[model samples]
Target: MSTAAAPAPPGDPALLTGAGARALFRAGLDTDTVGWAAASAQANLIAVPRADAYDLLLFAQRNPQACPLLDVTDAGSPATALAAGADLRTDLPAYRIWRDGEVVEEVADATPYWRSDMVAFLIGCSLTFETALLEAGVPVRHLEEGVIDPMYVTDRPTRGAGALSGPLVVSMRPVPAHQVAEAVRITDRYPDVHGAPVHVGDPAGLGIADLGRPDFGDAVTVGGDVPVFWACGVTTQAVVAASRLELAITHVPGRMFITDVPHTAYRR
Candidate 1:
């Protein structure tokens, strides 16, 4: 019997710019594993065919908090307006290929699944706020622990768009009680990236039964701190699961597409 390998420590978020991280990911850093890349420097990507891409776009528009769109690639293309010279096929550390809404395979390269009519959409993720949190002296637990943050699908319902609608999904971080106000104010400035906390404190209120277990990502030690929840791009995956689409491609949770945009761009 073999035990699974522990993921290597995710890179320092403060060290890499968006384009720098994309270049590194494209060159094969932690590009083969399902892991978190960077906190403040991550964005989500999803690819679907031209015939079905519009549905995702409309779905994103309907629930901007959960699926904020940053860039939409041209049909059959891998490059994005958000990150020049970036290849969507291999930049993310992991990719999930879905069929009929179920993940049929998880891969590192999406080139094999590439189709002539496929279009990729880049969405804003809460990791976009990572740098600011660190800069303000607020700890980023996932980065410190060398793992992905916890994510939960809440009891909350997102407004429907066509056939895509599901419960709101959230990424969580444990924040010290005193600085919670500062964290809220700092993240509130970027409404495009999930904005502020949707809920704070009690997990049961959001229908989360255990803080140690999460729907996605690795759970962190909440300890003496209160748990803070933010709307997450993973909500789109829930929609995809619910819709049962014939085919879809998405960056594995937390393995995001680092863009060319500076993290500071989101600051007010």
Candidate 2:
């Protein structure tokens, strides 16, 4: 299955939810339309043969913070259990075709790379909390500015699992001083989705020297707000880049699988 890239998806994003958002992606939006999860990111996906699935699972379980497994596709299938009728190969707007830890191609549809041996894992994304934060009166500056959230590689090291290990990656948001506490309380409820701020107020604490420049995604104005940091799923890409597996595929950083599962399903 495949989707053709359109200049833009029709109608309004405010009216789109769940499957409607999935449909917009399946229709082949550009690589930049990261509205599905508010700001989807890289995922822990494997295209290796079934014989190696066990290793991947071990890696995922060992490093849950960076690679929280949401749903894993049955061997050879592009459809995930997380979203019915969702074709993993096409539903996401962008994909990174990897070879030896290198991105060989970036494409809108990944049907050309689909393999019977592949298993795609849908990890919980922090972006899912954007809706909650907005409802709670926290402004998502990136959404307002129409850009992906700023992501950074931190001095923190992620726990190693099998061959997957890398530095912690984080996404940053400028929350107003008064709302920072509320943001934490609100996100603290969704542990499955990288809940709560790993670090707050000072980006320097995370070894991020310049907030204006991020290792991944786009930067937004910090203004009068405090920079709040959260664990980001993009750390998986850091592992992919570090491990340099012979052949693999992942959602391009900031391009994620939008699952049918509600963000609240992860509240704890």
Candidate 3:
């Protein structure tokens, strides 16, 4: 007898509610959350020991564009104010286990590695605004290709906070040249989700040599659309690796925590 897990059904992910997406992830549906729950917000997860939580908090405050703070959980707690009854260890589609600056394991469930001293930080994610871009007639290439958006490590360095410091990371999207202004205007309202384009036009200005390759996530075709860049919460992962913390946990790049909070809540 064969015993294989079933795959997630084909449908518009945007149709799922935040809690619905969490339940699917908890049930072992591992996939990126782009376009999921279009009306809700999404977040990047980073958990560190209680002793290092302050450093992470300071880091976010210093680099709001790259690490916008959303909701944080108390030490040893999996609960978050952003999502009622969501388990931090099991609610996300995937988690990365880090040790001494290296990713040691990628797992569907993080319960085994979660420690009582761990404090989880939920940082705002740019994926939350892709829906807005689509509604405004700005194309999001990765979503159309059904892949995670590409993220690049730029020449820009973020401000240091305590022991945490690293270069800024940005996620790229190909926006129609004429619609670039509309894309920026729509996203700028959601400051909590890495709002607005940090750079546009030439990738070299940010020291990115090739759009074909990215530091994280998959590369999508840019074609005639201009490449638009936005500060990404994955900057936290870079900081974690650079700081060489003994242990850390973060969401796999692109697989985000779908928050119950609506996108409108952050739109200004």
Off by over 4 Å in 3: 1-7
lDDT of each: 0.81, 0.76, 0.92
Each prediction's number of clashing residue pairs: 0, 0, 0
Off by over 4 Å in 1: 1-14, 31-40
Screening candidate 3 with a backbone cut-off below 3 angstroms (N, C-alpha, C), the clashing residue pairs are none
Error of 2 at 253 (Å): 2.2
The best candidate in terms of lDDT: 3
lDDT of 1 at 217: 92
Which residue runs does candidate 2 get wrong by more than 4 Å? 1-7, 31-33, 37-52
Worst lDDT 10-window in candidate 3: 2-11
Q: RMSD of model 3, in Å?
A: 1.6
Task: At residue 90, give the lDDT of candidate 2.
Answer: 83
Model 1 has an lDDT value of 0.81
Candidate topping TM-score: 3
Per-residue lDDT over 1-268 for candidate 2, one digit per residue giving the tens place of the 0 to 100 score: 8745474765555445656666776776755544554333323344555655666677768767656777777888987777778788888778888887888998877888887888776777777778789888999899888888999999998777676667889999999999999999998887777877899988889999999999989999999999999888777777777877766777776766766676677767
> Candidate 1 vs candidate 2: which has greater lDDT?
1
Model 2: lDDT to the true structure: 0.76
